[model samples]
Target: MVDNVSKQERSNIMRKVRSQSDLENVVSKALWKKGIRYRKNVKSLMGKPDIVIQKYKIVIFIDSCFWHACELHGRMPKSNTEFWESKFERNKERDAEVNKHYLSKNWNILRVWEHELREDFDGTINKIVAFIEHAKK
Candidate 1:
C-alpha cells in the first residue's frame, strides 16, 4: 500500500506526521478516566480538531512544535529552508482560517503546542477541564 503512492503525494497526505505526544496521550487518558467524552477529528468540523466536545462547544488542537511552529521550540530546517518556510506558512494560514471559522460558529478553540502540553500535561488538562466545565454552565 505504501508503495502505491508517489513519494511526494504520500508526503502531502502524511504531512505533519508527528506522533501523539506524551502530554496529549496522558491528558487524554486522564480526561477519559474522569469520564469526559470527546470525539477525535470529526470530518465535518473545520481543521478536524484533535479533540472536540460538541455538547460543550469546545475544540482542542494538539499541534506539534515542529509542525505548528512552537513559539519556543520551532526551528527552521537548514536542508530546505524555502520549502519548510512555505509549508509552515501555509499551515499557519490554514490554522487561522479554521480557527476563525470555528469561532464564527460560537465554538471555543484551544490550541496547545506539543512542547507546552507535554512539558506541562497537568496544567494543560486543567485548562481543558475547566473550559469544559465552564462551557457547560
Candidate 2:
C-alpha cells in the first residue's frame, strides 16, 4: 500500500520520533526519587537499553504496547498492515535477541510493558525497585 502522506511529510514525521519516551522519563524520575542512580539510553550497550545500572549489571526496557506488539493490547495499524506487521515482528525478534545476549552475560534484564505501567503506576515502580534491589544482592 502506498503511504498516505507525501514522502517529505513522512520523513518529517519519522524524524520527530524520539529514542526516549515520556514513560521512560516518568519511570526514571520515580527511580531517581528513590535514590536509584542509572544511565539513560547508553548507546554503547548491545540494545541501547532505556535504563541501565552499570554497577549492578542491570538493564531495563520500557516497551510501548504498540511498538513491542504486546500480546494483550497491540493492534495493527489499519493504514499500513503489511509494513506494521513486519515491523512489529522484527521488534519482537530483536527483543528476544537482546534478552538472550544479556542472559548469556549474566546481566539482569527487566522489561516493563506500557499497559502494565498504566494499570498500576506505583505497583510497577515498586516492582522495578524490588528487581533492582534483588539484582544488587
lDDT digits (tens) for residues 1-137 of candidate 1: 12555779768877865555565667778889878899876779888788889987899998888888776899987655677889999989999998999889988888877776667877878878887888778
Number of clashing residue pairs in every model?
A: 0, 0
Instruction: Provide the TM-score for each candidate, comma-separated.
Output: 0.81, 0.96
All candidates: CA RMSD in angstroms? 5.1, 0.9
Question: Best-fitting candidate, measured by TM-score?
Answer: 2
Shift in Å, residue 100, candidate 2: 0.2
